[model samples]
Target: MNDALPREIHAVLIPVGSVRLLLPNAIVAEIAPLSGLEKVERAPAWLLGRMPWRDDTIPLVSFSLLTDANAQEDVRTARVAVLKTLADDDEMPHIGLLAHGLPRLITITPDLLVRTDGGERLARGTSAHVLVRSDQAIIPDLHWIEARIAQALPA
Candidate 1:
Protein backbone atom coordinates (compact mmCIF):
# COMPACT_ATOMS: atom_id res chain seq x y z
CA MET A 1 0.00 0.00 0.00
CA ASN A 2 1.16 3.54 -0.79
CA ASP A 3 0.69 6.46 1.56
CA ALA A 4 0.28 10.06 0.53
CA LEU A 5 3.03 12.47 1.37
CA PRO A 6 2.44 15.22 3.84
CA ARG A 7 1.80 18.61 2.31
CA GLU A 8 3.88 21.65 3.11
CA ILE A 9 2.93 25.28 2.58
CA HIS A 10 5.64 27.68 1.56
CA ALA A 11 5.53 31.46 1.26
CA VAL A 12 7.74 34.35 0.36
CA LEU A 13 8.20 37.39 2.58
CA ILE A 14 8.67 40.35 0.27
CA PRO A 15 9.79 43.63 1.69
CA VAL A 16 7.81 46.61 0.45
CA GLY A 17 8.67 49.91 2.00
CA SER A 18 8.51 49.34 5.76
CA VAL A 19 6.20 46.35 5.59
CA ARG A 20 6.70 42.72 4.69
CA LEU A 21 4.23 41.28 2.23
CA LEU A 22 3.48 37.61 2.77
CA LEU A 23 2.51 35.73 -0.35
CA PRO A 24 2.18 32.06 -1.14
CA ASN A 25 5.31 30.90 -2.89
CA ALA A 26 3.32 29.16 -5.60
CA ILE A 27 1.87 32.45 -6.77
CA VAL A 28 5.20 34.16 -7.31
CA ALA A 29 6.65 33.78 -10.79
CA GLU A 30 10.05 35.37 -10.35
CA ILE A 31 11.95 38.11 -8.53
CA ALA A 32 13.49 40.58 -10.92
CA PRO A 33 15.45 43.78 -10.59
CA LEU A 34 13.32 46.91 -10.90
CA SER A 35 13.00 48.29 -14.41
CA GLY A 36 11.31 51.04 -16.37
CA LEU A 37 7.58 50.75 -17.02
CA GLU A 38 4.89 52.37 -19.13
CA LYS A 39 2.91 54.64 -16.84
CA VAL A 40 -0.87 54.52 -16.77
CA GLU A 41 -2.21 58.02 -17.27
CA ARG A 42 -4.90 59.25 -14.87
CA ALA A 43 -4.21 56.31 -12.56
CA PRO A 44 -3.69 56.61 -8.82
CA ALA A 45 -0.18 56.73 -7.40
CA TRP A 46 -0.67 53.25 -5.96
CA LEU A 47 -0.85 51.92 -9.49
CA LEU A 48 2.85 52.09 -10.29
CA GLY A 49 2.76 51.06 -13.97
CA ARG A 50 3.20 48.08 -16.29
CA MET A 51 6.43 46.16 -16.79
CA PRO A 52 7.19 43.78 -19.65
CA TRP A 53 7.91 40.16 -18.82
CA ARG A 54 8.47 37.12 -20.98
CA ASP A 55 6.19 37.42 -24.03
CA ASP A 56 3.51 39.30 -22.05
CA THR A 57 3.23 42.57 -20.17
CA ILE A 58 2.39 42.67 -16.46
CA PRO A 59 1.24 45.67 -14.45
CA LEU A 60 3.05 46.59 -11.24
CA VAL A 61 1.05 47.47 -8.15
CA SER A 62 2.66 49.70 -5.57
CA PHE A 63 2.27 48.16 -2.13
CA SER A 64 3.66 51.28 -0.50
CA LEU A 65 1.22 53.66 -2.18
CA LEU A 66 -1.71 51.37 -1.38
CA THR A 67 -1.07 51.35 2.36
CA ASP A 68 -0.41 55.04 2.63
CA ALA A 69 -2.22 57.52 0.42
CA ASN A 70 0.72 59.85 0.82
CA ALA A 71 3.28 58.11 -1.38
CA GLN A 72 6.87 59.16 -1.85
CA GLU A 73 8.04 56.52 -4.29
CA ASP A 74 11.71 55.62 -4.47
CA VAL A 75 11.94 52.94 -7.11
CA ARG A 76 15.64 53.28 -7.65
CA THR A 77 16.34 50.82 -4.85
CA ALA A 78 13.34 48.56 -5.31
CA ARG A 79 12.78 45.16 -6.91
CA VAL A 80 9.76 43.58 -8.53
CA ALA A 81 8.09 40.36 -7.49
CA VAL A 82 6.15 39.05 -10.46
CA LEU A 83 3.00 37.28 -9.27
CA LYS A 84 0.48 35.03 -10.98
CA THR A 85 -2.96 36.59 -10.90
CA LEU A 86 -5.46 34.63 -8.85
CA ALA A 87 -8.30 36.17 -10.87
CA ASP A 88 -8.10 33.45 -13.54
CA ASP A 89 -8.44 35.99 -16.38
CA ASP A 90 -6.49 35.29 -19.53
CA GLU A 91 -6.36 38.95 -20.44
CA MET A 92 -4.27 39.65 -17.36
CA PRO A 93 -2.57 36.55 -16.06
CA HIS A 94 0.30 38.17 -14.21
CA ILE A 95 0.99 41.27 -12.09
CA GLY A 96 3.97 42.61 -10.24
CA LEU A 97 4.48 44.10 -6.78
CA LEU A 98 7.09 46.73 -6.08
CA ALA A 99 9.24 45.09 -3.46
CA HIS A 100 11.82 47.07 -1.52
CA GLY A 101 14.25 44.22 -1.09
CA LEU A 102 14.83 40.62 -2.07
CA PRO A 103 12.18 38.14 -0.98
CA ARG A 104 12.94 35.44 1.54
CA LEU A 105 11.46 31.94 1.16
CA ILE A 106 9.98 30.42 4.29
CA THR A 107 7.97 27.41 5.38
CA ILE A 108 4.53 28.32 6.68
CA THR A 109 3.04 26.33 9.51
CA PRO A 110 0.57 26.93 12.34
CA ASP A 111 3.28 27.44 14.90
CA LEU A 112 5.06 30.06 12.88
CA LEU A 113 2.13 32.32 12.07
CA VAL A 114 0.37 34.33 14.78
CA ARG A 115 -2.26 37.02 14.33
CA THR A 116 -1.31 40.50 15.49
CA ASP A 117 -2.90 43.95 15.79
CA GLY A 118 -1.02 45.51 12.92
CA GLY A 119 -3.30 44.43 10.09
CA GLU A 120 -6.62 44.40 11.97
CA ARG A 121 -7.38 48.08 11.34
CA LEU A 122 -6.03 48.26 7.81
CA ALA A 123 -8.28 48.22 4.76
CA ARG A 124 -8.82 45.52 2.14
CA GLY A 125 -6.07 43.88 0.02
CA THR A 126 -4.47 42.59 3.17
CA SER A 127 -5.61 39.23 4.46
CA ALA A 128 -3.98 39.77 7.83
CA HIS A 129 -1.04 41.34 9.55
CA VAL A 130 0.64 38.48 11.30
CA LEU A 131 3.71 37.92 13.34
CA VAL A 132 5.89 35.29 11.80
CA ARG A 133 8.06 34.06 14.64
CA SER A 134 7.29 37.41 16.28
CA ASP A 135 8.34 39.45 13.26
CA GLN A 136 5.53 41.56 11.84
CA ALA A 137 4.39 40.76 8.30
CA ILE A 138 1.43 41.53 6.09
CA ILE A 139 -0.45 38.74 4.35
CA PRO A 140 -1.59 40.09 1.00
CA ASP A 141 -5.01 39.26 -0.42
CA LEU A 142 -3.88 38.30 -3.90
CA HIS A 143 -7.38 37.89 -5.25
CA TRP A 144 -8.49 41.23 -3.91
CA ILE A 145 -5.41 43.00 -5.21
CA GLU A 146 -5.76 41.29 -8.55
CA ALA A 147 -9.38 42.36 -8.78
CA ARG A 148 -8.45 45.97 -8.09
CA ILE A 149 -5.75 45.76 -10.72
CA ALA A 150 -8.28 44.47 -13.23
CA GLN A 151 -10.51 47.44 -12.54
CA ALA A 152 -7.62 49.89 -12.74
CA LEU A 153 -6.37 48.59 -16.08
CA PRO A 154 -6.38 51.32 -18.73
CA ALA A 155 -9.53 51.18 -20.84
Candidate 2:
Protein backbone atom coordinates (compact mmCIF):
# COMPACT_ATOMS: atom_id res chain seq x y z
CA MET A 1 0.00 0.00 0.00
CA ASN A 2 1.18 3.56 -0.76
CA ASP A 3 1.24 5.10 2.70
CA ALA A 4 2.70 8.34 1.44
CA LEU A 5 -0.22 9.14 -0.85
CA PRO A 6 -2.15 12.29 0.06
CA ARG A 7 -5.53 11.84 1.66
CA GLU A 8 -8.62 12.39 -0.46
CA ILE A 9 -10.69 15.54 0.07
CA HIS A 10 -14.44 15.39 -0.13
CA ALA A 11 -15.68 18.37 -2.07
CA VAL A 12 -18.68 19.73 -3.88
CA LEU A 13 -19.00 20.93 -7.46
CA ILE A 14 -21.55 23.76 -7.44
CA PRO A 15 -22.91 24.96 -10.77
CA VAL A 16 -23.08 28.73 -10.90
CA GLY A 17 -23.60 29.44 -14.54
CA SER A 18 -21.37 28.13 -17.29
CA VAL A 19 -18.59 27.39 -14.79
CA ARG A 20 -18.51 25.28 -11.66
CA LEU A 21 -17.31 26.25 -8.16
CA LEU A 22 -15.12 23.68 -6.43
CA LEU A 23 -15.49 23.87 -2.64
CA PRO A 24 -14.92 21.69 0.36
CA ASN A 25 -18.00 20.00 1.80
CA ALA A 26 -17.31 21.35 5.28
CA ILE A 27 -17.98 24.99 4.37
CA VAL A 28 -21.30 24.17 2.80
CA ALA A 29 -23.96 24.43 5.48
CA GLU A 30 -27.03 23.61 3.45
CA ILE A 31 -28.58 23.60 -0.02
CA ALA A 32 -31.99 25.22 -0.09
CA PRO A 33 -34.45 26.28 -2.77
CA LEU A 34 -34.10 29.85 -4.02
CA SER A 35 -36.87 31.99 -2.60
CA GLY A 36 -37.87 35.29 -0.98
CA LEU A 37 -34.84 37.32 -1.98
CA GLU A 38 -35.38 40.88 -0.78
CA LYS A 39 -33.59 43.24 -3.13
CA VAL A 40 -31.34 45.82 -1.59
CA GLU A 41 -31.12 49.35 -2.92
CA ARG A 42 -27.75 50.91 -3.85
CA ALA A 43 -26.19 47.45 -3.92
CA PRO A 44 -23.99 46.04 -6.67
CA ALA A 45 -25.49 43.72 -9.24
CA TRP A 46 -23.35 40.86 -8.04
CA LEU A 47 -25.08 41.05 -4.70
CA LEU A 48 -28.23 39.22 -5.64
CA GLY A 49 -30.09 40.11 -2.45
CA ARG A 50 -30.97 38.61 0.93
CA MET A 51 -32.73 35.35 1.67
CA PRO A 52 -34.39 33.94 4.76
CA TRP A 53 -32.66 30.97 6.35
CA ARG A 54 -33.44 29.41 9.70
CA ASP A 55 -33.71 32.29 12.18
CA ASP A 56 -31.54 34.61 10.15
CA THR A 57 -31.46 36.33 6.80
CA ILE A 58 -28.27 36.00 4.86
CA PRO A 59 -26.93 37.83 1.84
CA LEU A 60 -27.14 35.99 -1.47
CA VAL A 61 -24.74 36.60 -4.32
CA SER A 62 -24.44 35.58 -7.92
CA PHE A 63 -21.02 34.01 -8.48
CA SER A 64 -21.41 34.27 -12.25
CA LEU A 65 -22.13 37.99 -12.05
CA LEU A 66 -19.17 38.55 -9.75
CA THR A 67 -16.78 36.92 -12.21
CA ASP A 68 -18.43 38.28 -15.34
CA ALA A 69 -20.35 41.51 -15.30
CA ASN A 70 -22.15 40.53 -18.47
CA ALA A 71 -23.36 37.27 -17.03
CA GLN A 72 -27.12 37.20 -16.56
CA GLU A 73 -28.79 36.10 -13.32
CA ASP A 74 -30.51 32.89 -14.28
CA VAL A 75 -33.20 32.06 -11.73
CA ARG A 76 -34.78 29.10 -13.45
CA THR A 77 -33.97 25.96 -11.50
CA ALA A 78 -31.88 28.08 -9.18
CA ARG A 79 -30.85 27.03 -5.66
CA VAL A 80 -29.14 28.80 -2.78
CA ALA A 81 -26.01 27.29 -1.29
CA VAL A 82 -25.78 28.47 2.31
CA LEU A 83 -22.09 28.60 3.13
CA LYS A 84 -20.48 29.12 6.53
CA THR A 85 -18.37 32.24 6.40
CA LEU A 86 -14.66 31.84 7.02
CA ALA A 87 -14.56 34.86 9.29
CA ASP A 88 -15.45 34.65 13.00
CA ASP A 89 -17.68 37.73 13.06
CA ASP A 90 -21.24 37.31 14.27
CA GLU A 91 -22.64 40.16 12.17
CA MET A 92 -22.21 38.10 9.01
CA PRO A 93 -21.50 34.54 9.96
CA HIS A 94 -22.96 32.98 6.83
CA ILE A 95 -23.55 33.90 3.18
CA GLY A 96 -25.58 32.35 0.43
CA LEU A 97 -24.69 31.78 -3.22
CA LEU A 98 -27.10 31.50 -6.08
CA ALA A 99 -26.47 28.18 -7.75
CA HIS A 100 -27.93 27.26 -11.10
CA GLY A 101 -28.37 23.64 -10.07
CA LEU A 102 -27.76 21.14 -7.32
CA PRO A 103 -24.12 20.62 -6.34
CA ARG A 104 -22.45 17.29 -7.02
CA LEU A 105 -20.26 15.61 -4.40
CA ILE A 106 -16.71 14.79 -5.54
CA THR A 107 -13.70 13.15 -3.97
CA ILE A 108 -10.50 15.05 -4.69
CA THR A 109 -7.06 13.47 -4.53
CA PRO A 110 -3.78 15.28 -5.16
CA ASP A 111 -3.15 13.27 -8.30
CA LEU A 112 -6.61 13.94 -9.65
CA LEU A 113 -6.44 17.71 -9.23
CA VAL A 114 -4.52 19.87 -11.73
CA ARG A 115 -3.92 23.59 -11.85
CA THR A 116 -4.99 25.12 -15.15
CA ASP A 117 -4.35 28.48 -16.74
CA GLY A 118 -7.68 30.26 -16.42
CA GLY A 119 -6.62 33.32 -18.33
CA GLU A 120 -4.45 36.41 -18.19
CA ARG A 121 -6.65 37.63 -15.33
CA LEU A 122 -8.43 35.41 -12.89
CA ALA A 123 -12.04 36.40 -12.11
CA ARG A 124 -13.07 38.08 -8.86
CA GLY A 125 -13.94 35.77 -5.93
CA THR A 126 -11.88 33.02 -7.51
CA SER A 127 -8.51 31.98 -6.17
CA ALA A 128 -7.51 29.38 -8.73
CA HIS A 129 -8.76 27.58 -11.78
CA VAL A 130 -8.34 23.87 -11.55
CA LEU A 131 -9.33 20.68 -13.33
CA VAL A 132 -10.61 17.89 -11.15
CA ARG A 133 -10.69 14.72 -13.15
CA SER A 134 -12.55 15.70 -16.37
CA ASP A 135 -14.40 18.67 -14.84
CA GLN A 136 -13.05 22.20 -14.95
CA ALA A 137 -13.79 24.29 -11.85
CA ILE A 138 -12.67 27.37 -9.95
CA ILE A 139 -11.69 27.48 -6.30
CA PRO A 140 -13.47 30.43 -4.70
CA ASP A 141 -11.76 32.95 -2.44
CA LEU A 142 -14.09 32.73 0.54
CA HIS A 143 -12.33 35.38 2.59
CA TRP A 144 -12.48 37.93 -0.20
CA ILE A 145 -16.11 37.13 -0.79
CA GLU A 146 -16.96 37.40 2.91
CA ALA A 147 -15.26 40.79 3.13
CA ARG A 148 -17.14 42.04 0.09
CA ILE A 149 -20.39 40.81 1.52
CA ALA A 150 -19.68 42.46 4.85
CA GLN A 151 -18.98 45.75 3.14
CA ALA A 152 -22.11 45.55 1.05
CA LEU A 153 -24.40 44.91 3.98
CA PRO A 154 -26.14 48.03 5.27
CA ALA A 155 -24.51 49.17 8.49
How does model 2 score by TM-score?
Answer: 0.92
lDDT of 2 at 55: 95
The pairs that clash in candidate 1 are: none
lDDT of each: 0.83, 0.90
Q: How large is the C-alpha RMSD of every model relative to the true structure?
A: 2.8, 2.9
Residues forming the 10-long window of minimal summed lDDT in candidate 2: 117-126
Top lDDT prediction, candidate number:
2
> How many collisions between residues are there in candidate 1?
0
Q: Score every model by TM-score.
A: 0.89, 0.92
Alpha carbon lDDT of residue 128, candidate 1?
85
